[model samples]
Target: MWTEGQDTCISLGVMVCVVLLTGMARVLVRRHTRSTFIRVFVAELLATFQLCCCSHELQVLNELRPDTPSWTLTVIYFLSLVHGLTLVGAVSNPCGVLEQLALEQMPVWLGFLKIFAQMFSSGLSRTFMVWVWSLGISSRHFAERSIKCASPIHIALPEAFLVEMLCSFIFHSTVMHFQEVRLKFRIHMQAALITFLVFAGGNLTGAIFNPALALSLHLQCFHELFYNYLIVYCLAPSLGIMLMVLMFIHFLPWLHNMNRIHKNE
Candidate 1:
């Protein structure tokens, strides 16, 4: 009863379903076991999304600006580096706190390092997604341009990037706090205020603090052969670097000293 085109649609839907279900299962397993499964799942999901978004953006750009090379590429690459560094630093904060607690330790330097690593890790998560998405988009483009008529898919890169950033805020803000609570870190109004400020600042810079989102959205929006490389390698990385610097300021020497004392004991 289904036509050929309809069959293709069904297949795509099925694939998306499978991915979501798999991700859910991984989340549940991690919740129960407290293993590294959560980390792996988060990484894989982020990477795949980024690559797909990037691929689509690349396709979209080719159609929009056929002439002068758009500087979008440069912006996106720089963003990626900044995103990677900041995210890794932020996310690693919980892990550092945990490590400190486990050893009955408290070191300001270690705490700072942990926070830095976590933030950078977050950006790296985005980078992974962007690359994964890009690979898919590229292969699809190659097939369409080379073998058959090019598929015309309308992509909204900026919107997609914003959505992903919102998700990051939700996950990072609440889940991170939960981690702190479980680790028995003193929860204070000041901590909450600081966390809120950080999230707001991050979102203000660009909803997509992660390089992966930037790359995916950029690729989806503009895929001009001439400009594509610039966006991926340059613009994305720059953003990551900037983000890294901002997030690094959160680490304090006193925090590291406290952890070190406990760790040494």
Candidate 2:
């Protein structure tokens, strides 16, 4: 059995390798690809792959050291911040791509491509992680590989759906509202919000607000029915993003106009 320190180092090494390799791949793609579609596809694929690998590693580390909630929170926040800063020109979340489609900011075909890239990358990450664990570099990795699938959902299906929906709503709303904010500050705000959501909803549904991310981490688990995972993780988060977009585009302006008319009257 590896010591805790060795486990931590191995996890960190894995994350670092993923980040570096993704960065290199992205740079190569950008240099060689003139097609916008190809560039976007490569970007989305590498960014989402990096995200899923790091997130899965962190989750395994959390399980290994379950007693250190504060440590886990700190690491999550730091990783979120890193992702927000680094994922330039890439929409790693399928929900974000759908939101752009709804707003007509992205072509339908491009949005579909982005979503496909995200999902494909998610599956790749899952496979990659399984292979990494199979190497058994650390005792924790071996133990995690041997463990049977367990459901993250602890509540009823409806409640779990609501939890995921609320988390997605809050996250995307923040993203919408922070568009005018400076990048340095906006990324911090986003990271803080993600950290808070994960902390608050960690026990239920794994606080996964991204459909692609949920697919990568939980879709294959045997403890939950396929439909149940779809309802709570995939459908709910997408609906939440759509709801936020509708409110921002229509309801909020209508409410503001009504309030102004009442004041004028």
Candidate 3:
């Protein structure tokens, strides 16, 4: 369904290709440079690159085949797969990075840096996307872009908050559980899980559990007041990250012990 002539299609291809190639070149250079700052900064850029790429690609696919559940799911699945396959551990969502920190996968300070990078990347990506599409503050497309913000629509504030928490918990828990799996299969599982969750919860709250991505949307797409957006989209998911950590730590030992016992017996 993606033709070569449309401006949207051209922009999507050009931006993704350029961003990916740039990131790849940086990674290669960092291999020799081996600087911590460079590594983390590039990592942040790569992750944000994927994050914003996913956001825009989703819009393109949705528009191409709007209201078709299968098509949308397929689009999500492919995008998630691409994220997984890329050698870079591109975590475009700040909530995801927080979950990583909870699992002790990365250092605290670097996590903060990555969050900033991701936020900046999201804004940059959105700006580029708007330019490509000829969207501006007064454009109808600009107004329609509010979906990026993860702000409440028909749902009330409390319900929106609760929904985000639950979705984040589900997503984080799944990631932790599958953390040890081989890469070949892990991304597929994650992609499937994301597709399932998005289908179920996307309409409710845009199904974004990433605080950084939400921040990008808030700034660029003019989401609701900062207070409201922070409360429902960012804070709720942050709590969910902590809750997932606790649940994992408490249950993981028991599960390991049971596995050990079964093997010995």
Candidate 4:
């Protein structure tokens, strides 16, 4: 006869073991000079599996033991951060950082252009984030209105929002490093243009390009939680992307200066 607490403990233990093993695997895989696609695919698959397990376990625990305390929410917050960090770190293009550090080999104008492109990418990233959020909001609203034909549910849409923001930070920061490492054209003007188009397209399609947000929306649609598909898909990406851009812009100077010091030393 497994008690609720015992079951929860076992679940948590399994989650921890999975994470530790995944990290170890990542380290070992990184040491092997394998093909880029293989390494990336393996790393991303492992990381996603780890996060999915942890998130599923957490959601189950939250549901099974309703009326969670303050500390419980705090734990959820920490888990969310861990999930975001691991996911981004594992999948981020390894060469981006290397490119950013090699900016000294570039001309001043080229360096500025690189930074400018990053800013643009970061901005687009936020826009994409907001657009996803809007979609989630809109979908929920439309569904409820069509069914109940009344006002929208006044639910607080902050938890999923924060989770999405944290993930965006991890993603943009990792990409910024990759942009530095892999940038060849002095500026990612072409890539920037493509990103803009995709960002817009993602909004219209209701595909946030973010698994966590998608999960949150699913929870709402399936479990009677308040998830505004439109808001999630249309508005949240933009906000998240903008915030990331501001942080990266501030950090760009420090990154450049660090490279100079390293070279001199």
lDDT by residue for model 4 over 33-59, one digit each (tens)? 487655645654565456544544444
Per-residue CA lDDT of candidate 3, range 29-134, in tens? 6777778877777777766756675576466545655557787777678777877676355577788888788778899988888888888777776676566455
lDDT of each: 0.39, 0.87, 0.71, 0.45
Weakest lDDT window of 10 consecutive positions for candidate 4: 140-149
Which of 1 and 2 is ahead in TM-score? 2
Question: Could you arrange the candidates by lDDT from highest to lowest?
Answer: 2, 3, 4, 1
Off by over 4 Å in 4: 31-33, 77-88, 91-213, 216-235, 242-265
Per-residue C-alpha lDDT of model 2 across residues 74-119, encoded as one tens digit per residue: 9889888888877978989999998888889988999999999999
Off by over 4 Å in 2: 143-147, 222-224, 262-265
What ranges in model 3 sit over 4 Å off?
Answer: 1-19, 135-152, 218-223, 251-265
Clashes of each: 94, 0, 0, 54
What is the full ranking by TM-score, best candidate first? 2, 3, 4, 1
| Candidate 1: regions farther than 4 A off | 1-19, 31-33, 37-237, 240-265
